[model samples]
Target: MCEEQTVSLVDVLEEDEELEEEASAVLGGSDSDSCSYPQGYVKRQALYACNTCTPQGGEAAGVCLACSYKCHEGHDLYELYTKRNFRCDCGNRKFSGLQCKLYHEKDAVNSQNKYNHNFFGVYCTCRRPYPDPDDQVEDEMIQCVVCEDWLHGRHLGRVVPDCVELQEMICESCMNKNPFLWTYAAHLAGPEVLVEERRDESCANVPKKAEVDDVIEPSCKRSREEVEPSCRLKVLQASQQKRDQSGAVFWPSAWRSKLCSCITCQAQLSAAGLSFLLDELDTVLAYENKGKSSEQVHQGHDPLMSALDNLNRVQQLEIIHGYNDMKTELKDFLQTFAAEGKVVTSEDIRHFFEQQSRKRRRVDAGPFYCS
Candidate 1:
């Protein structure tokens, strides 16, 4: 996390470019320009031909410096250039752990090894045949039925991890299929949609990674690429459909995220929740041990129990929504834990709740939906 309080976005972009060049030099690549950078980051003279401006059977955009394609109105070149990502009115690509769905025009090579825009190849999947939208004459490519766009898979490379390539854009279908990815994407896409955390003004300049003390576990490092190859299983359990004793809905498949699939990642998320619970429980237990009356303990029990129940519910929901099959298993586990003769001690409950909570965090709550 950057500690600098007044760093500008422009400076950050420049730094990324500098870092990219330095990295290329260190790696002994042909040159910094020869290496692939995100489309937006390419220099203007190198990436002027945007697919959005290319017309069927018509000349490409003339105003473009590098190629014939032109950029559409309101497109933020700086954001794309700096961030190496963009969502044009042309449409945003959804990462599906496979190939990108959008058309990726290869940049043309400059003397410095920098490629010009409009030189990107059209990548298709499985050598599907279709018409090229760029020329609109019958050229071989994969056609997206939903969007009616041409996608060349060869340009996307042989294997795209959980990333679907469509129309030179990322495919949303695969992301929509996964719950955690969708939730994370939605939050990243628009912060206004999430419940805002009240941050102290003094901490405005602080980076989030620095504020947190715990070391990140390995499972939490699972990228979308790791999760894309597995087949998603959907559980058809009725208990999964019903609301719990509390006012919470249960979603299945909470453990399928690249992060949640690992036991280590599950532990990390649970520890966070359990830490808070233990603190509250300790405060209550302290007062009780000091000769507090039954009424006090009893009163404390409701709040404590509510917290426990909520934690449990959240865990179950995380598992249910995180992975498809885990939802049914989680529901069964909850029911079994609550049944007669079950060893449901406080410690057991606490441990179970924490384990599940960790998994919830591991499985980003976004992959299931995007609004």
Candidate 2:
């Protein structure tokens, strides 16, 4: 466990490129230049909601990456990131006058597709756009495991652990709606300990890895041996108030496995439309892992190896040397910016090369003297 460190949104802006890299990781380097309508609903793919076509408070519409470029170029768009089991809604009735150029025919509606406030370009209980123009407060946005909607840390009404990725979060609404989870989390939750603290002002739009210090073990963590299986649920229900407050609940990884899957519990879970809770693949982490696996299948080898395969040994060695030189020099040059926490720009790269060029020139023209 470590003390939590909060970073502002302005610090996140520096990671625009990092956001793209993270998206690529989730997308697994899928070709986004072409339309994806013909493919039907992708298991998991990068999604964008065109605000220009489907405005907020209206019909929610999402488009695949290719459609975002070809169908709604220059349109106001919300990067919904990657979503599971979604198809392109670009040419549908939601577009009104527009049709997807890549695919002429698409179903008017995708029944399996899911939508949240994110599709309308708003998120969290606050119902505001990310980096909200009206608000200046800097905070981290957390995604609820149930809704898949991003919520600000402040609005979560709880402390976000440093290692959030390692833990699973279920919002208060979801918790209350499915109170049975309280029993499972209490038994499976790990202790969040206080330790060395570090802060990452990285990409705001991406779910980066962090640490956890506190677990969700509430008063419901009584010894099961003391109570019969039939009476366990009642005891947990009665002791639910032992929790501090109604806030986002974090559980250790694999907490779902420890959840009571008895007939009664399953019946209750199914009644609440949460049978997916017991499914291992239902989690966002599972979706991301699938994306990564697909990416690995799509990209069989490192890009450098692919390039080297086409080159002669001499050319390959030359390329490797150049790469090494650039890597070393760039790292040395960027150390100053890293220390200062400055955002490096294209101009900075150019300036670094210029400095390198000058140093190389001075080295080559050693022992120069004016007589």
Candidate 2, residue 201: Cα displacement in angstroms equals: 22
Residue 113 CA error for candidate 1 (Å)? 18
Q: How do the residues 50-129 of candidate 1 rate in per-residue lDDT, one tens digit apiece?
A: 33333324332212221112223443221111111111222112111212123344333222222222222232433222
* Best TM-score among the predictions, by candidate number: 2
lDDT of each: 0.30, 0.71
Give the per-residue lDDT of model 2 (tens digit) for 33-143: 787777877756778999888986679989988888888889999988677667888889888898889888788888878898899888999899987989889888877
Task: Assess every candidate by TM-score.
Answer: 0.18, 0.68
lDDT of 2: 0.71
Worst 10 residues of 2 by lDDT: 205-214
